[model samples]
Target: MKSLSLLNKLKDYLKPIREIIYGLTLHEMDLETKKARGNLDQLFMLVVFGDLVGLPLLPPYYSMRLLPYIIPSLERWKRSVLRERDLTDFVSTDL
Candidate 1:
């Protein structure tokens, strides 16, 4: 409720809602992103870069300000985002 107004005010500046949802679809699938596991990174990026395409989660000020809170989390998120999972990982691990 704190900044819901800001979000509504900036609605026009948001990125394409659909692309924010799908931008990392293939990459995420390829990484075998666990359910609920990739949600935050995608959410963060969607906020950080959403305007590039229409549906940003938070206003830019909030997004930038929120960055500090997620700094440590962001590093881990980045690791997960950049992690490469070879097909062999699936082949090697128990299914």
Candidate 2:
């Protein structure tokens, strides 16, 4: 039928636009997922290494056991945790 052909043509014309929108949405979701993963990593590090900051919630033996798995990120986590932060630092960074 003419109507069915017109509908098919309309969908063909919009396919590129649909693909673009889907790609953009997927990209945005991926970025958000990465950010969330980073936040969780930071929190896990804080809990595991809190003793360095004098919290000492976990036993040293367990912390050492988990240390090897997180060794790559240890330096950056230490720097971020130990750095002196002012109100200006809070304002400058995306919290």
Highest TM-score against the true fold, candidate: 2
Residue 82 C-alpha lDDT in model 1:
85
Cα lDDT tens digits, model 2, 1-95, are 99999999999989998889888678667766897897799899988778667787789888878878888888998888788988885563333
Q: Residue pairs in steric clash, candidate 2? A: none
RMSD of each: 19.0, 6.8
Give the least accurate 10-residue stretch of model 2, judged by summed lDDT: 86-95
RMSD of 1: 19.0
Query: lDDT of each model, Cα atoms only?
Result: 0.63, 0.82
Q: What tens-digit string does per-residue lDDT give for candidate 1 at 1-95?
A: 85998888678556666567666556466555664456756676656555434666677677767766666665566576688998885563423
Which predicted model would earn the best lDDT? 2
